[model samples]
Target: MDPSTLLITFLFFLAALLYASVGHGGASAYLAVMALLGVTPAEMRPTALILNILVAGVGTFKYIRAGRFSWSVFWPFALTSVPMAYLGGRIHLPVRYFELLLGVALLFAALRLLIKPGGEREGLHPFALGWALGIGAVLGFVSGLIGIGGGIFLSPILIFLGWAETRQVSGIAAAFIVVNSASGLFGLLQSHPPLPAAIPFWMVAVLAGGWIGAELGSRYLTAPWIRRALGVVLVVAALRVLVV
Candidate 1:
């Protein structure tokens, strides 16, 4: 690989590490990096979603093995998200619209990363089925449309609503990302978008990073500063997408 490609791969690894450490799929960061690197719009969504599946899949397994998962807290949201995400994936937007929406999504993801959620209190609230399903539908559709896994949006909302604790949220988010990314990818397959030849190399890089990060996070490590720094990068990339 050339220097630029090598650097992008390294960034993908770093994005996976940082995101999976907190139970995320790193799609938003991947999208941001691709945008900043001038990757074609057609390639960005599939690439990010593919990487998300591997990274988030690792995180899901690690978090579940660590006993951080909650079925009650996870299912209601996922029940609705999967199908909607698939539907959204099948609907391709024009290039200008895609860039605009992706820029907005990146900004939202940046905000979530920049402002870390507060420590969980002792009392955790019960998951509200109606609210979760509705929110899941919205997030799922957006995830499919924008080529993300939707975990970035889900984590904060769950935390803010007190539906799940930090560790539980991580587990739930990881699983959610896996399913959504997979569903979105399957839906995207209808069009059979061309994937980059280097995808295998990138997937391996992210898988390694995701494994290491998820191991540390599920055990007892949270890298807030790293997340915040990455959030900064996302913001710059989002602006680039919007303006340039």
Candidate 2:
């Protein structure tokens, strides 16, 4: 294989490891890698979603087994995101400005993560159905528009808002990523985005990375470092859009 493909695969593996540890599927990081390597837009969204499914699904299983997942916390935010993500996936936005906006948003999120305290804390925000619906719809739109699974955004939100602890956030984020990705992929079906021949290879690569990472994060990795790594990922993604 060529350098670019090989590099993408390697990074995907690493991304899965880091992301799954925190209950993500690494879609943003994958999108960044694809953009830096010049992957076409048509391919980027669907491919990211597919990969998101693999990593997030693994994370979901692992986190659930670890007793970190809470259905009560998960259902509220997820109630509306699926349809919104599908709708967002169907509409095309102008690439340059859209990506620029997304990059800025990611940069902001990274900053927030960098400053937060390390250990998981008791939830501070009151969980309201309205808040859940609002956040879900907004993130769902972003997921469809950008091909992210929305876990990156959600994990930080849950933690910063004190809605969930670190490992619990991972569990929730993993489940969110899985559903939104599936729904977004369904929305992108009109284009029949060409699955790269190497997708299966990437899947297996992510599987291994996701399993190992989720295991470590759920069982071993400290909360602070996971947030730190997530900050690095957001920075890379932002740079891919802003400078790459």
Candidate 3:
């Protein structure tokens, strides 16, 4: 492999470890790194989505086996999100516009984390289903458009909506990401675009890194702290995208 491709593969591995350690799927970071590497946005989105599926699927299965997932809470959001994510993948938009929007979305998520009000811990509020579906649709669309897995936005929203406790959110997020990614990938497949043959090495690296990192995060990290740290990282990533 060329030095440039090897470097990108190494970066993907590093990103996977960081995300696994933090309970993130690493879409924003992947997008940022791809942009910095001068990867076309068209290639970046689908490639990242594929990586998100591989990583998040492993994490989700682990969480499920450990009884960390709550199906009661996951399905409603998936109902709306899966379809919308597919729709988003089908539509074509300007790369610059999409990246700008992604940056704005990340910034908004970070800001929400900073100022969110603390309140009684309700397990999936009465109106939360509606909110979940609505939010899921919007997030799913954006995720598909950008080739993201939707975990960055979905995890925080789950925390904000009081659907699940902070400790349980990561596993839930993993499952959510897996589902949306599958939908998005299906949408992309239907479009008949040529797949990048060189992506397998990078995918393997990300998968390994994400699995190991998520395992550690789930075992040792505190939920609230993980959420906060993820927000900080998102802000930095957003800045990187916006500036470049």
The candidate that achieves the highest lDDT relative to the unseen native structure: 2
User: lDDT by residue for model 2 over 1-244, one digit each (tens)?
Assistant: 7888899899999989988878889887888788788888778889999999999999999999999888988998888999999998888877788778878988998998887655556576777778888999999988887888998788778877888777788899999999999988899887677877778888889999999999997888777877887787778777877775
Model 3 CA lDDT for position 164: 79
The list of candidate 1 runs beyond 4 A from truth reads 94-119, 222-244
Instruction: Please give, for residues 34-103, the per-residue lDDT of candidate 1 as tens digits.
Output: 7778778888889999999999999999999999889988898899999999998998876566668767
> All candidates: CA RMSD in angstroms?
3.2, 1.8, 2.5
Lowest summed lDDT over 10 consecutive residues: which window, candidate 3? Answer: 119-128
Q: What is the lDDT of residue 220 in candidate 3?
A: 71
Better of 1 and 2 by TM-score: 2
What is candidate 1's CA lDDT for residue 115?
74
lDDT values, one for every candidate: 0.83, 0.85, 0.76
Give candidate 1's root-mean-square deviation (CA, Å).
3.2
- Selected candidate, larger TM-score, 2 vs 3: 2
* Candidate 3: Cα lDDT at 160: 68
Give the residue spans of candidate 2 off by over 4 A: 117-120
Q: For candidate 2, what is the TM-score?
A: 0.93
Taking all chains together, the TM-score of candidate 3 against the true structure is 0.88
Q: What is the lDDT of residue 12 in candidate 2?
A: 93
Number of the top TM-score candidate: 2
Clashing pairs in 3: 20-213, 20-214, 21-213
